[model samples]
Target: MKIFKERHFFRLVIVLLLVSMASCNKKKNSYTAVSELDKKTFASTQLIPDDHFLGDASCKTCHAKEHDYWQGSHHDKAMQVATDSTVLGNFNGIEYKSQGVKSRFYKEGSAYFVNTEGPDGKYHDYKIEYTFGVTPLQQYIVKFPNGRFQCLRTAWDTKKHKWFDLYPDFKVVHSEWLHWSRGGLNWNNMCADCHSTNVRKNYDEATHGYDTKYALINVNCEACHGPGKDHVEAARSLGKDYKGNGDLKMTSQTKPKALVDACARCHMRREQISEYYNFEGSMLDHYFPQLIVENVYYPDGQILDEDYVYGSFVQSKMYHNDVTCTNCHDPHSLKLKFEGNKLCAQCHVPETYDTPKHHFHPTGTESSKCINCHMAGRYYMGNDFRRDHSFRIPRPDQSLKYDTPNACVQCHKDKDNQWAWEAYVKLYGKPKHKHFSDLLAPGLRGEAGGLNHLLELAKDTIYPEIARASAVNVMTNYADPQVIDNLLHFLKDESPLVRGASLDVLGEINAADYVNYLLPLLEDEKRSVRVKAFFALGSLDEALIPEPYKAVYKKVKKEFETNLKVTSDFVGGKVKQGNYYLKQGKLLDAIASYEAALEIDNTNNIARTNLANLYYRNGDFANAEQAFKTIITQEPEYGQTYYSYGLLLAELNRVEDAIVQMELAIKYMPDNIRPYYNLSLLYDKANQLNKAESTALKGFKKSPQDESMLYILAYIYSKNNEVEKAKNIAKRLVDLYPNNSNYRAFYNQLNAVQ
Candidate 1:
């Protein structure tokens, strides 16, 4: 119960947010039909002109050599119709089983099909519509009603020549989000745009369905080179002597930034800000790249989860020094331009870097391999081992200090971090430069002086924009007046990534106060930035805005909704839509969106959490109670549930039950101040004077800045006849909130009692 009562872990719970949320009105379980909701995927094949696209066959006549390299590359085979030539998986009536689920693959005439559990939780014979990905492992896609394409969890290991479950350790039930039949596995919203050329996710809001369309079923010539119609027309009319440039300005000689942007459109793990990728602007103009953050990357920004190359590559000095994709890999073939140290020799001095004096290992060994030391990779998609493009020094010293992954220990599995650190020092000596990881690792961990260090990193343009953006994002975790000012100031930063990241933080914490500062960004050049601005000002009162800015606001709001519509087919999208509706006071719409999210996958507790909160707000406590109970059973360790349930119990006058829940909440959500603040009040209600006073004192010690908890402590002190203690707290409250008449009145009352 007295968790966080000692020293600060630096994980500050921003006050009792639940207490404010409980005051919201509650209603009966009335959900809007998914079709009836205004949300849409807004994906349409008609948005762009069909004539603009010239298929791969149209380019082969002039670019024969390049076309040959592209013909059977992973990009060319990224997606295809399920045919004898394209289908890689064994389909000779072979049975595959994993985690209580079983599936049988076989052929039905020319079509491939699998007998497996579907959305209905019963085994059905589903026809394979397409094959997704080609190397290492290949996934099969099955079509559902309303144009949905679901990737089966059971994938074919191309290397192994057998079927295996992608989620081997996971218990993938049909009703779960990660199930092959659920939204997480839906190809239209998740993987279609990247796999195919000119994909339109075309999700119809009225049907809860998809009409997903693509120009080509694979990543074609037009996918990276923009629409090839102009180039084709120019080439045909000009003949061999004609040297006129088509509007499509891409080649092997393309600059690092432009070329990287074209590839990163698909490669990077990002948020789409536009409905259709018309190949108009940079990647930032269409998609918001995810930053290096905890869980996805280590605190020091090495790959932990799937960063998809771009996020990691941008952090390297190679990218900053103007090395494009074509420098290391043949863009058309998607193969390494040179093997092993030869690739490093293309730019790096082979005589210097390729020697044992540098690597301290024998040549031709895996330990001496340049990539194994610098660009240590991780296995993804079960079997596809992809290298980290960051190309960093193997700093086992930093690994020892910050606990981040390093190639030294990564390869030397038998050795500890300490051993690696000592061996590295004996080889390279201590690093001279003050690495950003030294600052970022501690900052992300919430260690002392971390926030200030992060602020310095955010302001420094010398660091990678993505790294700076990460610094900008971390500022939101702390609460301070100075933090708000710093975030607002960062809104004008040159990097769109930093600017958008700052807008995200400002919009989240103080959107209303930032109306004037945020208005200019509604017309931001980058769509990702503009959309972030819209969401930040999402809770803003439109009527209060200046009339001159109203139309621009409306336009960005439309863009914002369009961005949301693109992802509306996923559970995360529905939850976002629900939040959008909730903010607009459309209670029924919010409830429907949440319900629809749950409908897609019943185990999405995030959707249920919002739904339960909505039910509690609407005064339909019965449904709220049930939803909370269901969530507890579904995910027992979710601390917010116990805390929220305790609030409802208090409202219901179940004092003893509420006390138990509050205590449990504190145990689970130790950093949170709400449970401690509320529990003190509950203890007083139960007439446990000693416990009430002690708990109040501990809570006060934990968060001296929280006035509400301080007020509770003052009340508890007064109730226990400690008038002087109560008077002192009341006086301090008056000083902190000088003009508050409530504090003044309470202080006078305490003084009189004293």
Candidate 2:
């Protein structure tokens, strides 16, 4: 395997207790004792059965100040009916065109409508059911059949007061995934959970329709605080001096992590484990936060995707020191507590970070602003720019080596990384950041002890848990026994992210020997941990599971089924469903699942890829070839299709064709070693001795301990009359694997030849 930390729960629990004590002292007169008040409304994490969501209007009576501040905030305007007052776009029969799509915005009898390309590849009038978001841009929603609400690819630039295409560069046909009418634009699946309060996506698996409901049409007081009926009733019945809050989660009453976790429920690129927000347990219980991985994040841990904030925030010194969303942003208004450098000066000394000597730029300039340097951001949703919350200092040195973006180069686009480095060092001295970037950048390339270097990063407690989890995620590339052993140590890791990640990698490698080691996690305190355990072990043969573990497995299997159900609408989820079926010897079911996924979106290459793989497995080589060909036609650059097609060709003894396909695979997936290894054998089979030696040697440079590559290289050298070179390699093979009789024979044979 080119594959694969510390518990922080106790420390957090202590912090929570201390913060709770301090909270009571901080608001002694207004609220009752935290314990006394909480007992009646909350039984552990669950609210009383009678409790219901009391809408935002009910909250205004008691929290007038908060309500006033929140009235026009992003949360309040997140979603709304397309009425004249609520709609921000100039929908006056204006036609906007992009990517061969001509969309017209207009109104018909007090109803907002868009004459745009829909699912049928023809123009149709779609009534704008709702407007999504408010500032920089606003997307219109059109309710389609099967209870699907699709967000329009045509959006209004609220600031520029003009219409624009979200993806201007690409041509989208009706059959493609990114088409406005497809599942990619689905509001019920992607947008609703975050935008509304108390949302329940009642999706029918059989019908493929949704009966989505929300207590509030937009994010409101109860959205973050949970259902407010308990709080409202308690305040009304128990009076101002009452000991407890009505079991409603007030951000003011909670500690920083709790408050941040509440906000992170929506403000994260997380995997949804449950259908609705339950207002229970830790953030991990409700959602699994995205680990900092390639594509999503740069090697230096800067945001490269729409990570929301929690993924980046958790990796920051601020989050490590218990700073939270409300520390900089007002909980109610969702605006900065202070403008410019003042916000940073809340903890940092103003003279140290805010002065010209430190920043080296003129005051009030974009370069001089603290956020411009420390919180480098990129535009998302076309124009809505979101800064990274990791609070890292600019490291142009890393940028020079790693190609990661730095604030210095972001503003001074004309300047190269060298210029940025020189300027930075001249002002601030050599940057001494002890963060994991140094370890991670090279680790990603698997250079200089590769997986070992990553293991060191994962084990080192100084790095954030999210970073550690990312290290675990990347370990999938390296599949070594030693790496698997090192990874097993994390099964009992303190953080759920770390623990869940351990299960994920172990399952990927199919470390069946460690399945016993993973059973305890099935009963873990966190829902994410338990869910991961089920996912890892769910497809196993029942005989592999010990009798002692069966009862727990039986219980978790139900949760596992629910897990499948909740995500069945997703292409990734369907891929997972197919895998489970394949593992359980249910071939037809697996094929059906993958085929159904393609029905949802024909452009879903993963589903199509899985179908091709199944076809190959079932001796339907012609069908498999056709499937791979179709995929290559649809996505010419997709490397996996070429690699898979090469394997099928090799299996069918089409060596010349296989060689061509494998060479293409190497071209597209350069980092993947399997292609190089396979191509080397193909050359040897064709009696191309020099080409075989060259290919195997190149692959050996990447994975030095690869036995097969080494053996092939030795055989090629020996055949080509390079006896001394062959002997040297044979000696290494014997030294590395002394127990292998073939290696011993090869070494002796080489010695006799020399």
Candidate 3:
């Protein structure tokens, strides 16, 4: 099986690369340009018909060999409606229990179904409408008429020889904003755009629904190959003139940038702007570029947050050395393009790498695999797993400090980092490498503990750009005037990625001096660097910097406009317009814009979030809560969403629900003192005086200088009749924000009560 998979991968690589090389000339031919330009001039060009979209079915006629190969690939079964042949789990009445909650899965003839407890604690039998995958685990879906579907925690019981609930006891609450009733787990909109062929999510924001159209569902070949209508029509007209090479000859195969754009669509960890975008379009136009940070990754660029495939790859030395995705992966089969040791031997010769002398492992041992020591496995969620793609050396030193698993200890799970480190040292004999370890050692060991080492590393060119960028993040935790100075220097760094990273750190400091330093970088050559600089300036003082940097801001603004012009004229444009209206405080305008934007792309969480905030401000708590819930479901890691949701829950008198949301907010963002302070207020309102006092104290301890916590503590103490303590804290708050009427009012009240 492995050998066959490898051979398939190699053939895919050869075909894809050859196609890419052939289409390397990105400049459009005169005739092609004239044709496109002419189409643009004709207003009534009919805008292409939906039926023109030929799903994967059409490709089978000319590319029989490739189509057959893909039929057995995982990509083929990536998503399907739940049925006897497609479903792989044991659905013959299997039951499982977790946390005292019971769930049952069973099949009736060809239909699969699961009986599980809902969030409200009632047993319900939901029919499994779709099956998601055929792998270590598969997800089942339950559909609704609104073109929304919920991914049931329950999965097919393939091994158990019966149907089993994947989420036996876990309860997932429905948020107003989530579309959980459409196609179920058919990968309709959420996972389909990148995985399948041309997918169009025809959503209607007014009705809060999707079009009940079959054409919009599933992956299609034209998705990656551009509009196959043109190619197909040409093939029919020219007959023998067109070559049917059984390769991915889509538009993306024409150029390196185009190929990278298509592959990165799914492989990279990025923030999506539009709900959907075309494969031939630029990635930056629709997605926010990911950085090496705690939110997206560990400081060391190891996977910490989510499975962002492209982000990890960009940080690797291999990427810098001109390695492309097609070099290893076959686009058609979506599998590795080479087999066994031979695959690794493509770049690493057997003369240098095949022996135990290089790998230091016995022949045929599990560790003998090329990826075992280099690409460590990291578990995401509780079940979904992935391996690091950065292709970095294992850092045993960091593994010991952060308890982050290292590649060395991962394969040798029983061994400690020390054991692995000693073995590595004995074999390699302390060879020098450019890693952040030298700078991180001091902070990791709790020695020489300010931002000194971090600042030095940020200024050092000897370290890799990614490592230096990582150091900027650590500096923010212990930011000082000197650290800010170092960051200013980084703004001028040659690498736009590094400059962008520096701006992020500068934003964290909230320093006026650093904001001034970033004004010039807004005009940097790279669009990413310019975007980061603008966002950083917005964070520092949005009102003030706009005028001073107006000239450069206008230039960068055009990049966004250009992106909108070239890309699909749908969700992307509406989202940018909505955000613009939002930042300008045109609430009604923003709402209308978001409504329009949602019509183009209902899965856009940012639009939903902003709309929710607008609803909350208008006292429409029900709608506000729903929007927040949708944001949470789509992106649980967005800590602030929970914080906002908790506030609305409190207003609705859902104290328990509010508390849970606030706790989740704290879990994701421990450094933010606001959630802790808000949680304490809820405790105080509930008359849990001791808990309220403790929670408030915890916030104060985390941010001793924060006046809000001080005020909250004083209020709690005053309510408890502890006048002396209340007066002291209130007096301190008055000194902090003297002009504030609320603090003075609280101070006087405390003094009088005393």
Candidate 4:
């Protein structure tokens, strides 16, 4: 009976194996058939054929005049082969070194080759197959055949006349960021979308790679003007008759909004939704839509940062006056529509504004220019030169009070804001302009002058909505019943942002009487306003909210819950929920939510980083280390993660590992201060006295006023036996933190030692 059972079992196993093999084969065949069908379907609906991207030679067939204008524009040579005609820098085997790294740019007959310093501290010779950009900054491109064509991070140094490395040495340490074997230096993912025309980053989900190629690799006129294929064909088929029918020009004559849309595609720093390709469909569709002044300007409307395109243009009265792009710039040539003062003269009378009498400088001198006085500002890079586009008078009073930049001090580098203010007072003598500057002065000095301005600004329609939002700063200082009542009126403003701001300001009052007024705003049309209202409602007395409003709040809350449920299938919804939880300080809940999301979709690195941050914040060092390590392994190019991990490691008391991690962090996120501060502390603990002092000094130089950084510097100086320096720092710390007895005692001890 036992022998019979064993034989039966063996037969059963064999039958099961045979059935599994047949099922596997069937699935393989089915997958192949389905893939083929999908390919066919995709091909049928593809926007443009692979062969449709004809070179410039084919474009010159009919529209010779248009082609001639394009040649002079920056777009024509935006990218080209590194021939003598295109290559700007002296590439005669010139070697350049920067930050302890070296690179050599040389030409071999018709071809250009560069031995560049890779991220790993090794010099690699890559053949320059293509050159990108025409002015400001240009990059070299090289193809790896089976791999991808990568744009080298090192750009040609035009002034220095050599090629310079842009990345640090540690980036090449077998990390994902520097691995040339895996298509390392491809700018297609980072920058190609804005620079190219009809770019399609055909990313394959299965392969996890991009099959990127472009119709035109630079910002062509056709890119902004729409595809010139149809227009060109029409012009060729029928001469001047093609005017209104086929030729769609992106000019003042055509759809004016198209020009702004074209510029905004690249210029505005908004989030991108789709792959870098798909220009027609991939632009930023939705953004945080409150038109706050800070979103567009500094508090004083002065250009504070490198917000070049949007900030200046949006603030100009030109935008309000319906002045389109073509009014200032010629689309074909891309130069200013007129030369010198003529550009400004288009709007302002030259006799009144452009003369030396008005500018108060010698004619033909640099300071005599209208841009020099009205729009004088600096660009962000090493070169602190370049005027601003926002044409406004220099309010030297605001500049003196707030230390904001002014047009006068820009040219007269020898003079301070005080000098400029005195000069302006002598010239113009304090005009009573109804600008926000007049309002912010008193608020900045901790006075109540902002109250009256806030009241006036809330009523004025001419002032931007942003100026009214600035009133929140002054509201913290002095309470005015009139201001509060006016803000209440804005609770029902047509703009959701204004209503949201009003709700936020109402929280300061915490008044039971205004609870009824705030309750209805909880059901605002905008999601952001509703979210703000929910929090504001939490601040008010529960009894004050009527039963009807409570029901409305519950309904709105239910709608959000239902929407979250419906969209929870996608990663975006999970991310949104995680953000909401993070903002509300529910850190552990956010971590769990993000972790669950990653379990469903492992490719979600954003969730992984967010979970790591939560763990770091909660003091769960072990989990934070594991999470950061996992992310580092998957994506080493993300340097900020390494810095965060180093911070966590330091908290864990793993000093040596912390040092190594901090070094790596500094190697990537060089500008960050946390790693430097922690590194200095670790060095002091290890008795590396000189290193600690140097690191602390560096940290102090970066952030002199940071209390923790000051404390660290003081401690480092004391350890180095510099009693005087240490006492000075301790005194500063004591002054900053007068309530802290520990700091006071430390300061006393330092003074005694000194």
- Displacement of the residue 3 alpha carbon in candidate 4, Å: 77
> Residue 254 of model 2: what lDDT?
89
Encode model 4's per-residue lDDT on 1-754: one tens digit a residue. Answer: 0000110010000000000111211222111122342232111112343243455565667557767778746677676777777877667888776555556878888888878655345677878877776555457777654335677656765555545554434334423333332223454443455566766555433343556667776666656655454445555566666553523335556544446645656554332222222223212221122232342345566665444354455545666576667788776676788877788789889889787667778877778777778777764333224456556788777776666778788778898888888888787777656675566445534454666765666556675554455554345456556767777788877655467567657654553567777777755544445545665555444455677676657654543443343224234445555655654557887787777556434545667777887888888877878888998887787677777777777777887887888778777777667777888988877778898888878778877887778998998888888989999999999999999999999888887762
Estimate the lDDT of model 1: 0.78
Task: Return the top candidate by lDDT.
Answer: 1
Each candidate's root-mean-square deviation in Å?
10.4, 6.4, 9.9, 16.4
> Which model, 1 or 3, shows the larger lDDT?
1
| lDDT value, residue 714 of candidate 1 | 91
Point to the candidate with the largest TM-score. 2
Per-residue alpha-carbon lDDT of candidate 1 for residues 216-260, written as tens digits (9 for 90 to 100): 889888777766655566566667864645345457667887788
Candidate 4 lDDT trough over 10 residues, lowest sum: 10-19
Model 2, TM vs. native? 0.88
What's the lDDT for all of these models? 0.78, 0.76, 0.61, 0.59
Question: Candidate 1: misplaced stretches above 4 Å?
Answer: 1-46, 541-544, 582-588, 667-674, 690-754
Q: What TM-score, computed on C-alpha atoms, does each candidate reach? A: 0.87, 0.88, 0.63, 0.58
The order of the candidates by lDDT, greatest first, is 1, 2, 3, 4
Q: 2 or 3: which has the higher lDDT?
A: 2
